[model samples]
Target: MARNTIRKDENTTRRSKKELILRLSVYLKPYKKESAIVIGLMLFVMLCSVLNPYLLEIAIDDKVANHDVMGLLEIGGVLLVLNLVAWAVSIIRWKKIYSINNNILLNIRRELYTHIQDLSFDFFDSRPVGKILARVVGDVNALKNLFNQSIQLLIPQLLNLALLSIAMLMLNVKLALVCIALLPILAIAMFCIEIFSRRRWEIYRKKRSNLNAFTHEEFSGVKVVQSFAKEKDTNDEFKHFVKNLKKSWNSAVRLNDMFWPLVELSAGIATVIVFSVGYKLVISGEIAIGTLIAFSMYAGMFWRPIMNLSSFYNTLVTNLSAADRIFDILDVKPDIKDAEDAEKMDKINGKVEFKNVGFAYEEGADVLRDVNFNVEPGERVALVGATGAGKSTIVSLLSRFYDVTSGEILVDGKDIRKVKLESFRNQMGIMLQDTFLFSTTIMENIRYGRLDATDEEVIAAAKAVDAHEFIIKLEKGYDTEVNERGSRLSLGQRQLVSFARALLANPRILILDEATSNIDTQTERLVQRGIEKLLQGRTSFVIAHRLSTIRDCDKIMVVEGGRIIESGNHDELITKRKAYYGLYSAQYEFLNEGA
Candidate 1:
């Protein structure tokens, strides 16, 4: 995998902030009634806030100027009532917004999770788990913040600006026009800043994701790092990556920082101009002192909303960048999918056929080239080959993990691609050289093979694979917890548990890829006996490193350079003294010498 390509160019077809907000609103439409209540409460809060400035104007113009004691008391009482109403409205809006934001976050998280599950394995194969986690958790959270804060303020902020502008203009048109004129310049500045910040932010996000992937991969392979004494080298590499991340981070923040102080400076200039002009109007008897005072207060209040709009504009850019990162994952089309008219196969007879099959992970370098093979129902086929000889690739194709580049793979005489993935995979059991066990109880792990299987059925499967005895010795028996990746169990034990899991699935086709390679000789013999019982009357394919495991297989195939050069039963192959014979004899002598 090339690290350079991890951060691609920004998506050319970027969605505008308004378009994103509209799409998010549609998602919230299902809860329209609650949304309506939230909007209403927010409006009430804005109305109360606007009334505060008006109250100050009235106090200066009417009560104070006229020296009416009774009028002053009545105005004070009304002000108190307005404050109380504002507090109530604020609380109601807070609760409603909080509830709506949480619900929207929950729904988005759930949808993303479900969509991830539906994606093909190829997507997971290329992307790191940590990067995926960041998109699902971190990026989604950023979007939620944007949706909750930006959206809730959107209508109220616009309305406040409009109302304040009108109130200010009614007092003095010249001053209002001055403030309005500055807006276009501010708008152009904001647009330029947003464009620069978006690109910088995208770079920062990519670097962050790359750092996450590197950290996750390193930690997961910590034992290997320690065993090879590569700690210093790894630490230095990590520091280099972090340095790149910090540079991008600082660049993004610096660009955003420049916008706000400039806006504040412009606001200051606008204020000085308003005060100078308004003071002259009052001195010349052209305007009343009350009107001049009101105009000054409204002028201050008016710029506040504009300042907030500027801040919101920056925030909107940040949110959109985060949203773009999230949508990138959701937008990726899965490389593998069943045909549109695919149907479920309830009973698979286990007969597999590959006709003129060719495949490559990358084009032109064929992993399996023009290969053809057939295994009848209940036949045991052993594939023997050196590394990179396409043995594992063949099994991967048979299981439909990757579709053939050319030709077709048929299971029970029907193309595997024409069967629903769930049904197709359910009919086959695969055990790899390295087994994976979830952090769960023993019983639950086994039951994962057949989700609806009863406890009794689980124990029966474990017993069949000779895993029941060791499981019972654990403190919790069937309920014994297998910590992360079953680290508590020995290698042989984990392999046996995996065998039992496969048995529980009761698959018609079985694939064993060096399943017993990690066990001791004694455990190997025990597992071999269990495997014999498990493989009885089932169509099985065995990829073996130790030749003894496949000596009794009905057919032995020699795969070399992506083609089967020789194939026959054990006795016939040994007599032929071909590739399979040479491999078997060499391993046979090594084992005998050790004995």
Candidate 2:
């Protein structure tokens, strides 16, 4: 699974630039109105900026040159007022743009999270939690910059360039044409750099996500790494990941580094041409000294905006790559979905039936073939089998985690597929051998099974499962933090807590997949007692490793190679001397000899 995650990261790093841009545009569609307003304000700001240089020209040529003090003061005052107004507008525009950009990012994050929740178990099974989180946090952040900085800067810069060009033409058309001619060449250079940078930036973003996934996995399994003395090996692997990350980052930076210098070179060439032509015009007395100076200033200002625009374009491409990754998650259709006319069930009778059930994870290999079974309300059925047998698969099918390839699973004679998924899952409580607990207080973890459960009810449930004693022994009692995955608690204690959780849910159907496997003998006895109470009125499926745990179940099914070889009550199966008998005899003899 870890190797597969790394491979997937490497593959995503190689996505084409076109696909990334298309995906980013789709994400921006929802915020188009706000984006338009931002662009309009940006253009307004640019117009004001371009007018400032022209205003300087007027102040120089008309007021200062003529020695008209009053005129100079009047023009100077107006320019001051205009500058102040432009500054205020720029601030206001930035505030509004950032507000809109952040809201859009929030919406994207929310949508991505909701989509992740909606995806099927199969999707989650194949993807790492850290990788998904990186997409949500890291990738989305990159897209935020695209909206807030890249778009905001690009629009204004382009407008400044356009307005400056018009002003230059008004002053001297020949000089304007010469300055503008260099723009196409500069633009072509920027375009080439942007193309190279886009690919490298995509690689950089994907490598960052990969590093995040690796770190997440390492921390998640830190205990295993420590126990197996593989920390050095893990660190070596991480160093390799970082090496690739650095390479990708350097490649992107190097490409971007060339951009500014190229813009400077183009502007420098245009400046030399403008001055050479303007000096001749000045010598012939065709243009004033002030006009020549103002022309040079505006010409430089014009190329400055062009340079900014080019930089914004580069940033836009990088952001688009990040947005593509985010949208890819959003575009994935959930494998399981509620039917158009799916109805919610308010009450469940807990009678389940699997009719002509056949299932397979992949083609050409059957996990469960033509499996037929029915469980009455309030009956406990024990499914016993070896590791690869269809026992766990049957429980998964019952929970509708993955629907059978060819079969109909009915709950109270209603096809499960036709029922709302949320309501359907609410009807059952599942306790796996390895229970997962949040990094929260014991009370909160218990309350996870039923969010609306009260403190008193939580305590009662824990007491019923023999977990209350140890829970109260903790310094903070029910409020003591579990730390990630309940690291503070023992396996036996964790199992007890899970038992209490399931019991508190008050579900009509209960599933225990080797639930007591991790508990000690003494704790197992207490858990067994709790299970009996929890199952008293609910239909239950017990996937047991220890035959003694299922000895008294209403029905015991011995499954081998996806086929049920023996089915009966404990005594009946033992008397029959079949598969069940053999299994029970072997376990009983082992225990007796060990004792």
Candidate 3:
């Protein structure tokens, strides 16, 4: 089984790498004009490289040795001109390459981000934020070098090698034959390096990804670590990841370092052979002194490309691993998407219905089963259940965060799946127990609900939520900066700000999952009034841990074991003296004890 698993992994890696190469090539298609110019310039550079040595041959044999001082000076001037042209071509090529590469990278990153956003909430539920972030920020960065080296080094080196080979054949056939003989041996050596080095590079990339995931998770939860006094434990855990990364990096680098020395050695040996055989040819009057000298120069030029090619192979191996990871994300099909012929759903009456809705994050572990419910256009419904009873899951389905596994959800008599995603989502507002705010000012966070909301509208939303009083009392009022995750604000304050945001969105369908669970009693009263105001004339779903908060809701639902066990108005449920009654009585006693 273990061997089978390893084989499967190997096959997956190979497939991913192939797919990565193919998909990345698509980005280059848009830059064909620039690529053509670059290739032309590189060919020009290669021409200069090939001609420089031949020019030397002429200067030595026909100008210098013949004592034609003016001819030598003229040849010198031509050589300088050739170099200047190559330099200018190189400058223009570099700028174009940079522009093309940067644009490609930007497009790739943007596509990844947009794809991630389109994915269903279930995709995020299975992966950590840190792991996803590594792919977006770190893995995407690996392709930067891939494009840079491709045009700048790989193409030019290959062109130079081909042109140099042709020049050598024209100058001296015997020396060219010798150079050709050495290529097969060098090629085999590089082929061996690439084969042996790829596994190590893959390992190195995996370790680096692991390290990044751990670092991001740890730092983001630094407060929890400090509160639990687990600093030492966390540090030790981090060190372990560091140690693994170091080991993988060392293994990869060791293999990578061997490639250079081996290429250089091959080049050196080839040069020595040229000198040994060419000297004999010159002595035998088979070739001129200048020809032998030029042959020697060409031999060096040939090996330089071989060395570069080997280095490029090493780079390819490293980047292929990163590319595989990036494509892994790109290839994931979004679990939720609109139907092919989905229609736009603009104005909604806010009537929501669940027709035998059933869902599960994993197969056979249903979180909701045959759940049927309905709410009028402006009803406030509260879902109450024990932990893991799927209250939040119900709300998630209502908001279309995850599609129902067995049935359908409809808004204003229209199936949500048949509506355009953006059009459907724009009509709804959702606020979770953990109110998240960006590391920006209060005004901006509220404005996030509606990007085009005027300042007056934003203030109106704040006032509607009863947050304006506290906003004005703050050190900078609406302009005050809320630290990351709104750490700078009190928990109650964050809830109010988030409430303001939801209010500003003016969504017809509002879903709040434990929105007030974190607030203290005093603050809960303050927020309760705002919540009442927000719920007016809007269909709302509330999931709450505190039963008292839902007593006034039009309908109270009791969920258990993925089924709605009881549901009714608070008075009706209390009259039954069943599950809801027991829950309320228990909560009432707990509150009295606290008092």
lDDT (Cα, 0-100) at 42 in candidate 2: 70
Top of the candidates by TM-score: 3
**Each model's Cα RMSD:** 2.5, 2.3, 2.8
lDDT per residue for candidate 1 within 1-595, as digits (tens), equals 2122233323323677777767667767876788778778767876776677677778878889899888888888988998898898888888888888888888888888888887866677667787777678877887766667655766667878898888877778987887677778878888888888988887787777778778888988898999999999999889987998999999999999978887888888888888788778778888777777777778787877787777777777876767777666667766677789999976988888889998888434888787888889999999999998999999988888888999999989999889998888888999999999999999999999999999999999998888999999999999999988899999999999999999998989999998888888888877777798889888999998888888899898889888888888899999998888789889878978999
TM-score of each model, paired residue for residue: 0.93, 0.94, 0.96
Off by over 4 Å in 3: 1-12, 16-19
Error of 2 at 435 (Å): 0.7
Best-to-worst lDDT order? 3, 2, 1
In candidate 1, stretches whose alpha carbon ends up further than 4 angstroms from where it belongs are 1-26, 593-595
Model 2 lDDT tens row, 1-595: 1233853663453355567656556656877787787788777667767777777788888889889899889878887887788788778878888787788788888989999999878777777778788889998888777766655776567667778888999999988998888877777888888777878887898888888889999998898999999999999999988998999999988888888898899999999999999999999999988888889999988888877776777677667668667767777788778889999966889889989888888434898888888889998999998898999999998888888899899989889889999998998999999989999999999998899999999999998888999999999999999998999999999998998999999999999999888988888877667778888999999999898888889999888988777888999998999898888888889999999
Better of 1 and 2 by TM-score: 2
For model 2, the local distance difference test gives: 0.84
Better of 1 and 3 by TM-score: 3
